[model samples]
Target: MKTKAVRLYGKNDLRLEEFELPPIKDDEILAQIISDSICMSSYKAAIQGEDHKRVPKDVSQNPVIIGHEFCGIILEVGDKWKHKFKPGMKFSIQPALNLKENPYAAPGYSFKYIGGSATHIIIPNEVMEQGCLLEYNGDAFFYGSLSEPMSCIIGAFKANYHTESGKYEHKMGIKEGGNMAILAGVGPMGLGAIDYALHADRKPKRLVVTDIDEARIKRAESLYRAEEARKNGVELIYVNTGTVSDPVKYLLDLTGGEGYDDVFVFAPVKAVVEQADKILAKDGCLNFFAGPTNPNFSAELNFYNVHYNSTHIVGTSGGNTEDMIDALRLMSEGRINPASMITHIGGLDCVVETTLHLPEIPGGKKLIYTNISMELTAISDFRKKGETSPLFAALADIVEKNNGLWCLEAERYLLENADKI
Candidate 1:
């Protein structure tokens, strides 16, 4: 069948084209993508062209589909897998298909598996055999595609950057209550990290979120204030890195010279990594949430300090199945609202235009509904064979009034209607 998807031809070139998709085999399942989210890495691939890692070496030489984070429903399942999934059943496809053969066979970034940016994807029995699909018959937006990144955050948290707690003495380290600093980046993932840190039961005494965009900082502060009321006392600061002469010193000044307990460096710039050592607390741990794509790219830091200070530096890529389950639970519990980060909404076609020019958009997540109709389509398309459910129909009304409000309200809607999806 013909399917519409975003294809990368070369550097700075992305096109929405129609192509014939392969049919589903007996042990496989076909999914019609309902929603997808554009990540920073997606844009990187668009700019770097064939050099982007997501593009398989052989496929990079040709036109290949682009996308990793997405939510879809089962359209057709192979006879053998019919018991596991059924038609019309809503499910979220974990895009990272780590086959034994692919080196980076992790979810979301695996070079061997195609992503969910297209209208439909066929899940091979191998993935089913591995058990990657998660069933969710409730309210989930295209932004739900962010589960992978959230899983990465969980992975970073599991890395244990802090020192273990003794009987009484609270030797500050990267453990449960370690302070976290999200630096340089102010998009969906960074925003999501901040939300996760804020709502986490073992949240740090102080959470510092930084970005180059004044508007993003202001929005984050406003959202944090509104979402977290009981913990309203928590300090949320916004600094304009663009105007700051010395960001490192500025960040240190905010910490009162103690340094952060745990730092999440979301920015991929070389200078950010180079200066990360100075801002890090004596025994602080730094989680490089974002890494430079170029294999040749390297960052410099003080090795002597790294060894002597007992500080840790760790990095995480795509998440695993366990992380995704926790993320969904968090979403369902209304702890971390993934929809809040969605700043832009459009159809599949707008992906190339908006996602490609992401640095210009000043907000959180850019959501794309795959089934959206043509006339109503701007960011995503979610119009399937069935009629729009009354629940979503109501959401569309709210989304039209205010995009931000839709994000805030959708989480509540999802929670209230959780059991009835």
Candidate 2:
């Protein structure tokens, strides 16, 4: 089979090219990629290339595709797995395949033909054996693509642990009815964290989301209304910390002078990390959720509180398959909408440039439809582009109807009318 994909040769080396895919083995399955949401991890991988752990060391001779959070449909099922999976079924993958053989080996960064940027891919036996090939029943493929990142947030929440003084056993998850704060929490992943915290079974009495950007804070507040969170019995507040004289003191004041029990640091910045530490209540679990590309990223923490007050820290890279299942279930039930993370849409032809320069671009998720030929366009600009293109005109109408957010209707319209790659 022939497939078109963005392959990584080395650091800052990405090329969109057509190549021949080998026949799938009996232990493999063939799939057609529909949508993929570009992640910051991809940007890190593209810049570091082989230096990235998940990326293969010999990528120059054996180039690998670049993408991980993807959703697609099964095109051909091999005989060995025909009973469990069949052709025509829609699916999403749990890209964090921490197999015993090689924990670092994963799709996208580690594979030659099985990344999300490709038009078609061969799903190997390792993915199915690990139970990472999930059958998705959602009407929108972007939601399926978003499930991966959402799972990461869920995993972070689950990974956070609280402790009882002098006890060895650590209690898992954020403290219920406790004060919680998400520092620098108005970006893409931070928005997902806010959504999961409010809607999940575990609830915090007060949820404070802080960001340096007032515009992003307002935008997040618009998408997730404080009034709506209050209806669900959680006090949600968005604060622009840049305007505050002392962010740590100001955030604690919002919780009635009590420090937060669970604090999530969304950015890798040292100041943000230190700020989260200063606002932790007794037995507070501060989760450093951001993945820093620098090898020697460091931040100072208070060991005095760790010894006396039971304050601790935990970090998670990505969620497991079980977390992915939970993410899909929540999305299917309409409990959490990952749509807030998406800000731009593009096609296969745009993957090379988009992936190479993702950090330079401003937005949440950059969604890619693998079979289309179009430049990366923001949803907010759909109306402005509508003057020249009929595709953008129809998409603008659909987005505006949905209150300026990307929806299934917009995706369907774009897929049906846009030029196929």
Candidate 3:
């Protein structure tokens, strides 16, 4: 089968090209990709190219497909796994396949045959054996693509902290029923963290999300309303730190000088990292959530607190299989909403440029429907644009039916009418 895909050749080189895929082997599965979400890590992979740890060593010789956060439909299932994995089943993958004890050979970054930013892809034997393939029965197909990022947020909360108290180790998660903060860059991932933090089983008493951009802070507040948080018995505060004279002092004052129990640094800026460290309370867990492209990026730390206050730092790149399962389950149960993380939608043809300039684009996740040919549209603009464009008018109807949010009906209508739009 022939399909179009975004392939990485070398550093700063990405090409959207047509290629013929080989027949699926007996142990493999063939899938038609529907929705794939662009990630910042994909931007790093495109720039770093061969230097990226996840990129295959021979990527220059054999160009690999470039995407991982995606969901698709099983087009052809191999005989060996026909019973367990049948054709026409909707599926999402936990692309961080830690197969064969290897951490670097993930689908989007390393695979030459499999990627989300393509019309179709093959599921290797390793992915199935590792049980990374998830059959999704969700309402919205975009949720399948979104589940991967949401899993990362789930893993962050699931991460355990250990403290040494005279030879006894005490382990715990984000201090249950305590104050929490997500610092800087309340973009896509930061907003995901806020949603999870507010709705998880162990909800925070006070959740504070800080961002320098006033518009972004307001957007986040609008989606995850303070009224909703109050209904959940959690105080939610959105702070535009740039407007404040002393941001750290303002954050500290919110907690009545108690400081945050868990501080998640969503920006890789050195100043933001340092600020997160300074606001840590006793036994505070500072999660460096953002990944910096620069290898030598460093920030000053208060080692005195590390020694005396039981404050520590932790960082995680992606979630595990269990975390992905937890994310899917939570979404299925309506405990958390991942759809709010998406801000833009485009087709596979636009993925190359979108991946290149992702950081410059504002709003949340940019969803790409691999089979469609459509321009990127922000969900917020559907209503206004619907006035003139009949296509957007149809979309506006779907979004309104779902309470002004993107849902399965909206995704189905968009995909069915993508070519017309």
Candidate 4:
């Protein structure tokens, strides 16, 4: 079968090409991709190409598709797995597949035949055997794509530690009923962390999210409403640190002299990292959430505090299978809303350009529906653009019906009328 995909050839070389897909093997399953959300990690993979650890060394020779956060419908299940797997089953992948203790070789970065940025993909035997393929029966398929990034937040919270008596051990999540802060960037990933922190089972008493961009921070506040958070017993504060003369002092004041119990550095900037470190209370866990692309990226830390005050630092690349499952379960149960992190939506045809200039784009998550072909449209613009464009008009009506938010109804409307647009 022929499929259209965004394939990586070498460093900074991504091509939108049509290629023939081999027949599904006995242990493989063919899936028709529904939605694929672009990630910052994919941006790094595009620039680093073969240099990326998960990307195949011979990527120049065997080009691989470059997307990991995606979900699809099972088109064909191999005969050997007929009972276990079936056609029409919906699934989201935990792409950080550490199969057989192999640290490398994930679907988006390494697998030549399997990726999310394509019309169709084949789930490999190893991925299935490791149970990385999660069956999703959500209202909207985009939830599957958003689950991967949401899982990263879940993993960060799960990996955060607190000292128990004499020794430090994993608390398996953020400090319950403690103050928390998300530093620097309130981009897509930061927004996810905020939603999780506010709505999770162990919700924080006070959550302060900081960003440099006033517009971005305001947009995040509108989406993840501070009023709603406060009503839910979380004292949510969104601050534009760029406006403040002293961001560290402002954040410290929000906690009433006591520093944040858990501080998350959402930006790769060294200054933000340093500031996040300084605002940590005793036994505070500083999570370096954003992965820095530069190998020489270093920030000065108060090691004295680390030694004496039980302040610790940790970083994680991606989430585990359990984290992915937890994210999905929460989204399904309406405990968390991953859709708020999405601002723009496009089709698979825009994957190449979107992947190449993702950093330049200002919006949150740019979701691509593989079956459709359309330009990226902001959900916020639907109402205004609805005046001229009938397509946007329909979308505006749908979003309006769903409290001016992109929900399952809006997704279904867009998919049903994708050709009309």
The candidate, 1 or 3, that scores higher on TM-score is 3
**What's the TM for model 2?**
0.99
What would the per-residue lDDT of candidate 2 be over residues 80-169, giving only the tens digit for each residue?
999999899999999988889789999999998899999999999999998899999999999999999999999999999988767789
| Candidate 1, run of 10 with poorest lDDT | 377-386
- Which regions of candidate 2 deviate over 4 angstroms? none
Instruction: Determine which window of 10 residues in candidate 4 has minimal summed lDDT.
Output: 164-173
Model 1 alpha-carbon miss at residue 379, Å = 10
Model 2 clash pairs are: none
Better of 1 and 2 by lDDT: 2
Off by over 4 Å in 3: 160-164, 383-388, 400-404
Per-candidate TM equals 0.80, 0.99, 0.95, 0.96
lDDT of 1 by residue, 115-158 (tens): 56677777666677667788865576543676766777776666
Ranking by lDDT: 2, 4, 3, 1
Quote model 4's TM-score: 0.96
1-421 per-residue lDDT for model 3 (tens digits): 9878899998888998889999999999999888899999999999888999999778889999999999989999888788799888999998888766676898999888899999989899889988998999877788888899999988887773646567667676787788999998478899889889889888789999999988888778878999999999899999888889988899999999999888988999999999898888888889998999999999999999998998899998889888888888888888888777888888877888899888888788999988888777888788788898888898888877765677888888888777821
Off by over 4 Å in 4: 168-170, 383-387
TM-score: which candidate is best?
2
The CA lDDT at 35 in model 1 is 72
State how far residue 85 of model 2 sits from its true place (Å): 0.2
- lDDT per model vs. reference: 0.66, 0.93, 0.87, 0.87
The deviation in Å at residue 332 for candidate 4 is 1.0
- Candidate 1 achieves a global lDDT of 0.66
Provide the clash count, candidate 1.
21
